[model samples]
Target chain A: MNSEIVAIDDWNVPHKKSDGVRNRKDYLERLLKTERNMKDDAEPLVSWGFHHYFHGELTRQDLDLISKDRPILIIHRSFHEFIMNSRALSLFNITEDDLNHLSKEEKKFASLEEGHFSERGLIAVMPKVMKYLAAPQRLITGLQITENYFQENGITLIANPGSMYNPSIQKVKNYVFGDEDTPFKSLFIPSALYMLEHTDISNLLKTTEDHLSWGEGKVGFLPKHIKLFTDGAMYSQNMVLRDGYLDGHQGAWLMENDIFREAFKLYWDAGYQIHVHQNGDSGLDRLLDVLDENMKRNPREDHRTTVVHFGYSAFDQIDRMKKLGVIVSANPYYVSVLSDLYSREGVGYERSQQMVRLGDVDRAKIILSLHSDMPMAPASPLVLMHAAINRINYAHEVAGPNQRISALTALKGVTLNSAYVLGIENDYGSISPGKYANLTVLSDNPLSIDPLKIDKINVEATIVEGRPFK
Target chain B: MKNFIFVIALISFNVFSLCSNDRILVAKELVTLDDLYQDANAVYIKGNKFHSIGSKEDLIKKFPNIPVDHLYKDSVIVPGFIEHHVTSTASCNNNEF
Candidate 1:
């Protein structure tokens, strides 16, 4: 069998055997493979020495190949890089003296200072050092970014419920083959709720019915479940858990039960599962009651109703969830950003210790997955993995060490658990054959590394559909 | 005669009250919202048009005789979700594609 040489050690991502020259050449090759799915033919793999945009020599890509498949590495080109084509060079108005690798602290200061492409500058500028592109180009970049980020953290898939492009599922169904932005391992489908709500439920159902008429299997509208939110996030102190709030307040209920029931009845009758975002334990209880009323007709186990962010689901509620078969999707994102807030809520006492109860979640055997809940947090699986494994404060002290999970379990949350949660378990998750080739190449084996240094590991490559995006 | 009619009405009420309601879904995990949902809740067909809110125990006291409803038990229940400004399902009848 023909083989591709991949750095199984330090760099883990794929590359062609270089004819001679090295450095950034393999990185460039992988980037090409990510943009254009498969390679029709091989090209001369020349060695391109490393260019940090900082020290030593400026970099170069053999100025030999220029095809439709090869758009200029528009983002990586800088004024100093000698081999950059005229088009790539024209994009950047800076020089080598002006370009230097930014230290973590220096980058922070630059964000505040604003001059010479430093902290106070437009960090989003396409050229400084490979800035992420937004649109038209977004799909290409987005897919690679998502693929790389997920793989490095062992996340096989991300079930994206909503996106701007697929406003309604018809648009998603109409999608031809693939989207560049979708670097996800399997199908990143449009959600049912996104289409149903806001539109007349009748019209939405009609659309659903019309689409389903196309027959079963693939390439048609897929309705996993309709998502509903019971209340606000716990980070904001707005969950409706049973024993009231941590404070003396009763969290607000966004919707009245009766109104919720009507929506449920309509959708349930029409055939759809409910995936609700219920943060507080009390909020979960309220949602379960509604599901119970409809239980005579709607069964929980087969229906696969889900509850997210059950930050304070009590031990008793957790037990009930086990019998009911309600899956829990936690924002492991909470391990960072919002940690101290929950920890200090009790004034010196670790409130988060009491808040995020992992033991309750693990004991339920509920299908559990971790996520960044991005925008609130950055979309990195390792960050979530680190949080789930550590369950500690920033000072490296374990916040709820007793409730911490193993690095292996944390990996599953991002990989197997997440793939199932996204409803693409069959394709993503493992290194299985006949599945879409989505892989994450980590600089170090997570199993071998110290758990605390997990987040510090470098991502060598993020592969999507067998192509590497390095 | 009026007293006789009143007595008949009372007897009918007693007969209805005597009938045991359907059993509530009892489980190790019961988050009965019998409190948030009350007897005064408006009913349409069989759906609660407007649920009166209360806690599990409180609602149990209010309707102790009636079989408790386990519809909202143990699960997170939000009242109503309305997605506004998001994409609405509409066909592009303009099959120009």
Candidate 2:
């Protein structure tokens, strides 16, 4: 297949065009201007602060831009809800006819609604997504989905630890600011960096403006942290813990404590915060010990360290975390979706009380930040806050009813508190003056609405750096 | 704009960082990525670190107080920018690719 480049002919710099945000040109335009010599199907991406749309065959939005050098086939979400576009539809052989025979319920499934797919349909999506696993388009789409889902909420700055790279970061930067100058702001904890250590740690930060690179939350300026993962997930009964479930398994461990501790110290000393993925109490137990040792080795002020999913944390240990000033970014969204699984496998009703202990979090003085454990749950800050306060799961069953918090505090998890977690509270946590006019217009006041109905909350507009997104 | 009030409540603290359209970095410089190096072929930005960038001699003459590196020339250093929040998910060129 001969590759026909859909090149962006003219590039332009970003100019401020919004109330408070900058009217930045898109990245493709800047890239066109930068590598002004390249001959290809590159589209010119112009941006206005957080909004960037493309001017070529490629579609660019925010900081992530996609273009084609040739026609390619790829598998995507494969179902509808229609997140993916025509080109993707062409590659995967998914057709409107495929939906022609489905009932209304199946129509809902295409929108990524959680439910059982026919064993055959479930089996089929894997091979298709796998078929295009190598496609940058798929990766781009994954990040895009992650952003759209999370951004609609009140989250201002946050990042992912999975499958994120320097290249992806640059793409994010492009989408957020386009070819224009940006009053960018964001924070990232790249979990893959856990796989790295020693000189590689020193080197990744050394090479490139690795510190300044953009990512999923890369739309704006952000601090860089090393996001570490040690186990699977809680609901799946995959997280590693010392005690076995009522059943026989003790669960899984991605790494030994000593090795993880050493790596944490390496990252910590390298000036990157250690944001680990530890869900089980046993994992948290081990994590704290490692963090304790690392802190002993390299004590710095406001390390802003954390264990991303500190599920089922013990009260005493939770207090210890507060004393140590470590953060716990919980995925209360799981409260709704997987309460039953955690109840059965991870903990019983009594232990459940401690699962997503938001109330205890406030008491322990631990800075709490809420998140939607995406690919597993919806990434709505409103929904996460509601679940945190309500402690309910997908079935509307309260996971740990006592663990629920008030609407005010829960809201902090997705907003102000998240800023503190990233050490950017001084910059972009709330809507105070001298801060970026990044705001999310909501359908109603959170304080006024019932907590459980929060996810039903609509984002009228996502105003980034003062510009609105429709 | 009505919904912004809700989003405003969500991120009230960081909004200050986006102060004025001009002189946004008007607030005191918050961070500096110092020590750009060789062997790394790294981006040694005298960027937000120093007051200015130019000929090493001129920089030295201007600020004899500050240390000067030959890098002021080869390195195209500029001001460090502040981005609000750019989620990687919005991009079309990621894991979905």
Candidate 3:
């Protein structure tokens, strides 16, 4: 049988011979013996890779052997969940008694024998592992790689909505500014409200302000906008919702209620454009509450408080958004990838179909733009344009026919609406005099061409400041 | 002698038309993207700026004696597209084809 293996290590097995899963057991057995021999050396378990999707391919016995070598943490593809080997639990100072004492929900995700974890279990161990990967050198190398990739795709601007937490602003600023050959501009927004306890806000603010001219015009720090994550991702089944999941698993909020409110007030009082990463209806409810409260207290106009990754929301929420003047930077590509599976496994068919309700948002006259959410979707604006226009899924079926928009509106979603999201509409959204001479030259105008062929239209050149970069 | 005189009259008219207007561009359709005269079939360009846009006959009549640059008569013209959200983030780095 033919199958695809995304990524696997060849530490012990002959990778050339392991062409298909028929030989997968032999591959696992070889790795198991290597682990057994390694344990005999009395060395700490540094790292080992395994695929969660390859459950049946490898046996429990094989996993047990590998776990004996050292403490092991196995993260799920979604990154919200993880599993630990027997040694890994001890390494993290978690005991059998502690596992048994966990709340029933936590216990459900924790398995003592298999060392499997999800949701709560993963969150418990993530902080410990993140430190290893949060080194500045590692981050700069990764950014350099991604930056080059963006240049090849004709991208000239990058926005980091939150300039805090795992990656330090100074490190990113230094790396980008230090390198004169940096391909595109970087826009950073100060966030990290959750780190208020550990962070010196005054110092962070000073440093953030200094980063405004970090790249001498190429890198800009937007002090007007702040980022907040309201809920978890939809694919991870962690997005909070008013109605529970089909399997009866209640989703979670990334920030506590009080913490979210405090963060909102700090940014709102400061007159910053607040961008929230809200995914589910319940998450929207929380955000709407804050927005309503902010409006009542201060009564600002065109606040442009945006909801990012707005993956799932109710029909009523769109109207609420319009009244509150909340705009959306939604990812319809999420609908294309997850709507079908989410329909069956997560939310019911109805709610799943309603994911990324661009149609309702459009009818409400809400300012809607498309976002790749980068890591979540491909950062091709044309692909985002195509997805918004066709609303096609993995099976090539229209996920939501009503949600499909015209090619013109879809083009605006990527350009004008996107500029609106960044509050840079006056400078870069449209082709008007005095605006930046930025143009994405296409072989065919999306406005007058076949909607299905929008993605196929080759980008001949990207013009920035009247000069073309092919 | 009559045929020669008629040919001279047509050539003189063409030269006068060429010298009167800066340049006239004719196309299958020109979308000015202006609120007025959005669906124009021709455009009149004086120097580097757009002078006027209308149907081919209207443009010709507006600049009755002008040089015409006929191109893309089978194609369409539109305002250049402005792509807004070309993000350079983790999304561009993952699952690229």
Candidate 4:
């Protein structure tokens, strides 16, 4: 991605702060000008990385005032919400008549007046927007950049859990990523919730199994693995908490409790490796309860049921995870970027500082891996390792010293343990006999370097199947 | 006849070894993450698999005739990194958002 695009996509960039736009009006003005300059004025402007925590909620009036002639849609940083201008609403043809068709619960989240949609509301409108977002060329270009980005960071393999179920998108992915020229291989794990949305529970497994043929040269579906979501994203501050948010705002669930349970049981009985995207302690509570219930109903040993994006797990949950044979693939970047701000405003300091709580996971001997969750954080393993090892926030203060892990352990999070989470450890992850000759050459050893400088260690080259890519 | 059989066996062994894609990757350090060879300075590659890993001198002694690539002699080598939980649509979503 280009620097200008990064400036628009990342809130932490110097452009957002140095542009001298403080209030909503100035911010909207700058955003409109920058976006218009980037794309044609008549073309719809869809941008991400808008956070209410930093700039407060933006209304239709704020956006429409600046972008009166052009269409604009600003996706929340979490990708769970959207705020659009009047023109954008017209462009998408979203009207009150359409809103009337939605169920009352869904309507509550979609407001035509405010031009804001979230969770169920966003789901309701996604089809209308996806055509533009998932355009073949657009997706191809984005994926080409992603491939280069991964290779530059010495990533030889990337496993995308909860990949979209759209065949067209998958075809585009195959075009770019499945090419033999691509250095890294991609494994797509089907999303249980996405499948359930398009097909009945009876055909869910069949639909998932159909994706097995999607692989070409370098892209393939990870068989017998499915992804499920419990709560909303932590970035939106919508993750369900045990004690609730300090501001008294309630969190939302991505999947209803009964539906999540039914889906979990279906995959569990089918002998699939289940990966749950859980954030808050309350969400973890629900996940653990379901796992325990399933275990009692039909005990399965060495299941390797993984908990993904463990954003705010409790201390006791670690022991429960061990007992349930659950491993973790956590986004340590949450503590690195959001901990300080969330501590002051969102969840209060205690829970915010302990967002990832990986140290506790490590202490319990639970297998732990780290992920960028990509647009949530840069897809750099070194960055993830730095966050895990140092636990340092944007202010350069360690949010939770107790949660810090050793450098070697942190390295495992991005290498061996990460492959274990994907159930591909035998072939990838480590430099072992009979495994693929995949090695990442680094400027320095992460285990011997300063924890704070781990991210600074440059990737010299990556060897994939005995072929080196520099 | 026994001496002739011995010569044939040695020739077959040498031919087999030469035909295989074998090489030793000499690096400043190899963080194998393999339990038996946690840290080493050399890795023997046979085709697309890691045949063995040990100190440079040891691997050299074992496979004396194998080609050695000192290209990464100044760099540290570790297992290829894996991204366990990224979405393929994330980049598209970022660009098209």
* Candidate 1: tens digits of C-alpha lDDT, residues A191-265: 333344345555655654444343222223345445555654453455565655344744544444665667667
The interface RMSD value for candidate 2 stands at 13.9
Cα lDDT, model 1, residue A269: 66
Q: DockQ of all candidates, in order?
A: 0.01, 0.04, 0.08, 0.48
* Candidate 4, B-chain TM: 0.70
Please provide, for model 2 over A1-470, each residue's C-alpha lDDT reduced to its tens digit, 9 standing for 90 to 100: 00111211111112211222112344334433433444443322212111111221222121133333322321111111112223444455555445455555334333222211221232224234334442455444444444444444444344444334545345634554343222234444454433242235445445313545444343433455666666545644556655557766555554545556666776677777667777777888887887787767767778877767666667778777877778877777556544654565435556755676778887767778776544233445665667777776534576666677887677666666766666666555454434555545555556557776876766554545543344
Candidate 3 lDDT at A296 equals: 96
Score each candidate by Cα lDDT: 0.44, 0.47, 0.61, 0.83
Clashes of each: 41, 101, 8, 2
| Stretches of candidate 4 exceeding 4 Å from the true structure | A1-30, A97-101, B1-22, B94-97
Ranking by lDDT: 4, 3, 2, 1
TM-score between candidate 2 and the true structure: 0.57
Per DockQ, the best of the predicted structures is: 4
Ranking by TM-score: 4, 3, 2, 1
Superior candidate under lDDT, 3 versus 4:
4
Q: What is the TM-score of chain A in candidate 3?
A: 0.77
- For model 3, the superposed segments whose C-alpha errors exceed 4 Å read A1-128, A134-138, A166-180, A200-217, B1-97
Q: Judging by lDDT against the true structure, name the best candidate.
A: 4
